[model samples]
Target: MERNLELTIRMDNDHVEIDVYEPESGECSQIDAPLSFDEHPEFDAAVGNEIYSWLSLWADELAGQN
Candidate 1:
């Protein structure tokens, strides 16, 4: 089944966090080394490249909001 993903991002001056959740199925992928989003390859590529990609992507988004 194709479900819309929900991302919860929390960050501060010293830390960055990205979390993925498929609410319908309750599958969650949190901020951890080698973050896994196998069930959802879309995000697997978005934030899969270590913490670099994860923070980079969201950092861009957050910056744009300002």
Candidate 2:
């Protein structure tokens, strides 16, 4: 199986939007929550292992930071 995800981020002076879109499944997940600036490390030890680990979500965390 092949996984294809399209990421789109839009930010302004007030807010940041992170979107992960999977064209194969027609699924889009908006996965960023509000937290303290200090807690926003962008990448975590779980590396997308919150439920089931997948490399793409890990990439998402990384891409959002860059």
Candidate 3:
């Protein structure tokens, strides 16, 4: 089964921001870091995975609670 989640990424001059949204409950979470992709080309993918992992854990926790 799939959870109703949305992930958005935003990049600016100084930082990169990631927003995770759960439409079911109208809840959201954010993660951000300095824009250092010049030094770490894989940063975007890494952050994406981290966000996905976090959402999965959060869903599991909510399921357990229910």
CA lDDT, every prediction? 0.59, 0.57, 0.76
Per-residue lDDT for 19-45 in model 3, tens only?
A: 878787788777777788468555676
* Tens-digit lDDT string for candidate 1 (1-66): 123568888766544477877666586777633334345464455565544644565577678989
TM-scores for every candidate against the unseen true structure:
0.44, 0.48, 0.53
Worst 10 residues of 2 by lDDT: 43-52
Of candidate 1, the 10-residue stretch with the lowest lDDT total is 32-41
Q: Which 10 residues in a row give candidate 3 its minimum summed lDDT?
A: 37-46
lDDT, residue 19, candidate 1: 81
- Runs in model 3 deviating more than 4 A are 38-66
Backbone clashes (count) for model 2: 0
Q: lDDT (0-100) at residue 52 of candidate 2?
A: 41
